[model samples]
Target: MINSVSIVPDFFQRVKTISFPEVIRVFYDEEPRRSKIHCPFHEEKTPSFHIYENGFFCFSCGEKGDSIDFIVKLYNLRPINAAKLIAERFGLPVSNGPLSRQDMLRLARAKAERLREKRLKEAFDNWARLAGQQVRILAEAIRLQLEEKGLDIEEDLLPLVHELPRLEWWANILAEGTGEEKLELFRNKDFRRWFTCKN
Candidate 1:
C-alpha cells in the first residue's frame, strides 16, 4: 500500500538521511558495503552495484541516486509515496499533508515547539530525581558530622544543620511537588545557593 501526498523539500531532506547500505540489508542478509550485488538496473553477472551511506550506484548501467531515489525506482512510485513508505518503515511519523507555504511554516514551528517542550520535561524530571537523592545524602552527611562533634558542630556545617528542616521540605517538594512549586523552589535564592554548593 502507498500513501499519496505531495512532499516538501524539508520532508525530502529528512527522508534522505536514511542510509542506503543499511536499508538494503532489510532484503539481503549480506551487508551492502561488504558484499556487492548484481546490478538491479542492468543484466550483469558480476556484482557492480554498490551501496553507500548516502546513496548507491550501478557501474554497469550508470544508475545512481540516494536512498529515496532507490525506493522510487524500485517500486515505480512517485517520490512522495516512496518517502512516506520509507519513513513508515523506519517508524518516523509523517503528518497527513501540507496545504501551502505558510501552513508548512506553521506546522514546522509547532513541531519544533513540541520537541522543545518534550526535552524540557525530560530534563526537569531527571533534575528532580537527582535533587531528591542529593539533598538526602547531604543531610545524612551533615547529621553524621553533627553526631561526631556533639553541640560544637563545625562552623561550616552549622548553617546546613540549621537548614536541615528546610532541606527536608525541599526534598519532599522535589519528590512530589507540582511544577509551579518546583519552579518557585528554583527561584528561591537560599535553595539555589544550597543546591549549587552541595552539587
Candidate 2:
C-alpha cells in the first residue's frame, strides 16, 4: 500500500529526505564510512551495504530498499510499523498507533542488539588502538634490537623483529579490514598477546 509512490502519505515523502546515515545512527554507534556498513540483513566480512538519498543496497546479499525498508529488515518489523517508527524517531508528521506488545518486544530486542554491537565495536576500537601502538612499539623494539639497546626490558622485546611479518598482518587488519574482520582479530587470543607484551 505505502509502496505506491503516487498514493503515499506526505510524511513518507519527507522520510525520503531523511538522511539514511542519520537513520543508521539512531541504532548504531556512528555513521558508516563512505556511506556503507556491514549488511544489517546478513553477515558479511566487508561493508557491502551502501546507503543513498532514497534507499540502500547491500551488494553481498542483494537486499535493496528505501529508508523504511532498511528499518524493517534491521529491526524485523512489519513495513507499516517500520514506517511509523521512522516517523516517530525523525519527528515527521505521520500517525502512529499505540504499540502492541509484540512491537514493544521487537523494538526492545533491536535496541539490545544494537547495544551489544556497540559494546563489541567499542572493545574492538580499544584493542585496535592498542594494536596501533604495538605497531609503533614493534618498530621501536626492532630499532632497539638493531641499534640501541641498553634497557633492562630488552629481553622481552629481542624477538620483535623476527615476528614482524606476522604481527604486521594483524596491524593491517586494524588498518584495512571491515568492521566484522577487525572484530574478528580482537577475538583472537594470540593477537591480544602481542599488544600486552612489555614494550
In model 1, which regions exceed 4 Å deviation?
A: 1-98, 147-156, 197-199
By TM-score, how accurate is candidate 2? Answer: 0.51
RMSD of candidates 1 onward, in order: 15.5, 7.8
**Candidate 2 clashing pairs, residues 3+ apart or interchain:** none
Global fold similarity of model 1 (TM-score): 0.45
The candidate maximizing lDDT is 1
TM-score of every prediction relative to native: 0.45, 0.51
The pairs that clash in candidate 1 are: none
Q: For candidate 1, give the lDDT.
A: 0.72
Query: Tens-digit lDDT track for model 2 on 70-188?
Result: 88887899877787788666545453344677657666676677678678768767767777677756765676665655454457665765677776777677776667777677677
- TM-score winner among the candidates? 2
